[model samples]
Target: MYRVLPGFHQIQQPNGSYFTVPDRYINLFPFKVDKPFVVQAFDRVMERYVVIKKVVLPDSFLDRQPWKRAQRELFCMLYIQDENVVNMYSAFTPAATREEMTEFYIVREHMQGTMQNLSPPTFGEHRTVKSIFFDICRGVQYLHAMNISHRDLKPENILMTRDGDVKLCDFGHSNMEDPNANTPYIVQRYYRAPEIICETMDNNRTSVDIWSLGCILAELLTGRVLLPGRDHVDQFILMVRFLGNADQLFYSVMNERARNFLNTYREFLENCQPPTDIHSHFPDEVFQGGLSGQPEECRMARDLLFRMLVINPDDRIDILMVLSHPYLAEIWDRNMNPDDIPQPQPPEALRNFFRFQNIFAPETLRDEIFNDLREFGERFNIFTGSKN
Candidate 1:
């Protein structure tokens, strides 16, 4: 969390309507997203402290394809640099196109919150929940080693800083597609993932992000909502009443209109009764309130939440066995492979353009984002962590 400044002496930064570069920075919550008041601002011209994201879009039918959902989250954070990913320094968007109506800010590095408010009464220590689930499973194992598919992992897209550390943030329903193409994809109905609901999901959609990181570590070890589904058929009836009926070749790629709604959820799980295991719905006070009264970290967090709450994405549990799960082997780091990590360089074809019916203005979106931060800052390595 890089602070240590009172610099930029006389102060300025808050003048608004963005990127003709006025606002010297300072709005701190006037609540803005579509109404556009403040997503937050504070630079005073690089005196530090950032974060002011936006990729606004509206006119909807099925999809205008909001510039391919803002180029699958700025090309998956411009090709996945890690330290648990989330950086983006600058991408002002005073321009407009793709059938007009645009606004796309991007200035990141600002945290100390979210993991959905670190579960219950603002979760503080308790041995930093295995180093914040080993920095969110090493940021989803560096986005499945770049094959990418963060189809929305939950816990409000995990962020945390006041020295806690976790990162992965909103890859607007990320891609590299095919997680068994059934279509209607948009996670977060209790972290969806029954092959994103039997459109017969096939393409190992990164095991539907390991079943939404085991429902975000079972809602940070029981701050509740391990499967609090309210839609998508009550999130497949609370995941078939807690990981129960799933294999008939997992609905043989469901397409008889979702295999007749998976045979009426297998006749409503054969008249509801036997279906609870995952330590009988985390009984012992949800592992004595998030790994506290430790019984070997609640028996390795109930065997890593039954191998990450699998209803079957080919029997989930991946992020490298969740970074060697022994309840997160104390933030393990077996030199995280993938050619010694830190990626993010291949992107240049018109800076990976995704036909948003070309329009642009603010001086061509500030000369194609400062020529993509000067050709990806002279090639790769832009991590911005240790608090950018």
Candidate 2:
């Protein structure tokens, strides 16, 4: 029974089970019902506060007979060791009578907001791209140093506190070192390294994570995804374009059966089309792939990002080299001018480029667009190549 301030309150369930009621409630900001939420139910009947969380693991997770337990073990270890990691207070197995029984609740300490929530498009400059990436790098460095590899490191799994610090969560696919064992096949396809995708990363799971790290950095900077693809096939097409054709290692991951499956789709893969012109709002003049930031300070960071997005994981930069590079130095260098830092802005030419003289306007707001163009005047040179 849950201990209340003066007495005990029994929690009755819609199902047959019963539990204790909490003494006090803690508000989880922006809580969603089925998805990750904020409000946490807690009890502090005595001097100590007890918090409970309801976690449900799908039954499908158990279908993978080989890796189900392993995945759980990995998550449990990672969760408990890393305080920055999502904290799980307890867990309960589902009731035995439930059909398709894939439910279990993992009680956890509720964290504040997700990285997506913190860095919403509407939120103005607080943590710049550089700082956000540095924090990520530090977290990654820790994971690598501990010999752990987070197979899926995406923005969705990144949790942010009220103070704005980021914590890497979701270790469901993470891998820990086993000296006697070889690295297992792991990685979320989109963030998947070229080597891993190509099967070249036989034991290089760490590099795969680094590749995702770079993609994440680029997204934070632009507020637009750098390598967005909807599915495995779409992602593969994008990667091949950047990385070229996969090597033997890439083909090695698939069994003959899987290879045969791919062979059937070979014709379709060959016919896939690339975007006519990939639009990067980044001005060509300002972006010198190697010349950005301080040559001695931000070089590693830049090069690593460039490499991570490379079509081939085989050619990607190793995180060790990335961590040692001078480019990363800018992360901690305070002497740099804040004003010199590059901020995300639309191209100068695009600002006032589109001007419609209200010719089609109901004769009302037409003037507003023209007035805006007038205010923009010569300061904004809008260009539409097709208009010519």
Candidate 3:
């Protein structure tokens, strides 16, 4: 066993490289007690700063399964290779054998900070805001194209580099778009999509991600959460108030529980006023000084927001469409030309592992993750290209 130190600890990886991390955690969220211990670390081999996420393994099978998320996150990091997405260097257990492992560690590129620390975008920095939003869209688009959905897409999950580039991180809540998986409470409250709120998300998983992007973009423009709902009930009510009552098509897809909830607030629904346009939230003056110094930019931004924040998932704009929108035209041309982007094939082994069987048991997931780690070590390396 590695010696525990008060000041710092050196964690040796399977590949002989090691990371030196401080004893104290760099991040600890009060709301999520089960969150992994995140600390800043120095890579001895790479000679660069890195973030090490330490996940404690539960001793008993009866306990909650944190490894499930860790397994999915590890798979996603390995599968995706994008500049806009955070790069995970490696994942491994400290113990020599899988049965002896007590902790799982994921080593990734160190980011300066999350978007939460940044100041709100002002009118003078409209183009900069657009660029940031463009980066986010590119990340989301790449994930969607790879058949993954980052269910949580709030500012906190968006990390900023020292050079001001934004990259998506925290894949605990991310997964492949499975229509059978109906998780209404997957996303954070403020950025949650209406379809997710109403439990009407049939096969439209990626669109919920687009809704979150819309909320994030709105926050970037105004410096506040677009929909600050106190609770689930209030969140749905806020959506109704902002986008007006759901259409017949929206109601048609909603399950029995959602229908019952709507009936509970039938009186309030009847009394709610007509929904306001996106312009009312972000007026022309907001985009006067920046955004090409034209009012048309405001219209385009609003138009994009309107389409993105659509109440109906079917009517919502896809990631590709969002990338193609006029507001992000310049960034799209410069960085994200369709021909230049490379499409990666999703791992068939992982896909079959998730789809073929009931892998909910902790033991099953643990074994799968062990196999994945072994395969990853053999086939892939950061310094060199894939062996296969």
- lDDT of each candidate versus the true structure: 0.59, 0.47, 0.70
Which lDDT tens digits does candidate 3 get at residues 334-385? 5354445545455565565445434578887777677777677566542232
Candidate 1 deviant stretches above 4 angstroms: 1-42, 45-47, 52-62, 65-103, 106-109, 112-126, 130-151, 154-157, 165-168, 174-194, 201-210, 215-246, 256-295, 298-300, 312-388
Candidate number with greatest TM-score: 3
Q: All predictions: root-mean-square deviation over Cα?
A: 17.9, 21.9, 5.8
Candidate 1 residue 374 C-alpha distance from true site, Å: 30
Q: List, residue by residue over 154-189, the lDDT tens digit for candidate 2.
A: 876777766667766665565554333344345555
Candidate 3 least-lDDT 10 residues? 24-33
Model 1: how far residue 83 lies from native, Å: 22
Q: Which regions in candidate 2 have their CA more than 4 angstroms from the true location? A: 1-30, 33-53, 57-84, 87-110, 120-127, 177-189, 194-204, 257-302, 310-314, 334-388
RMSD (CA, angstroms), candidate 2: 21.9
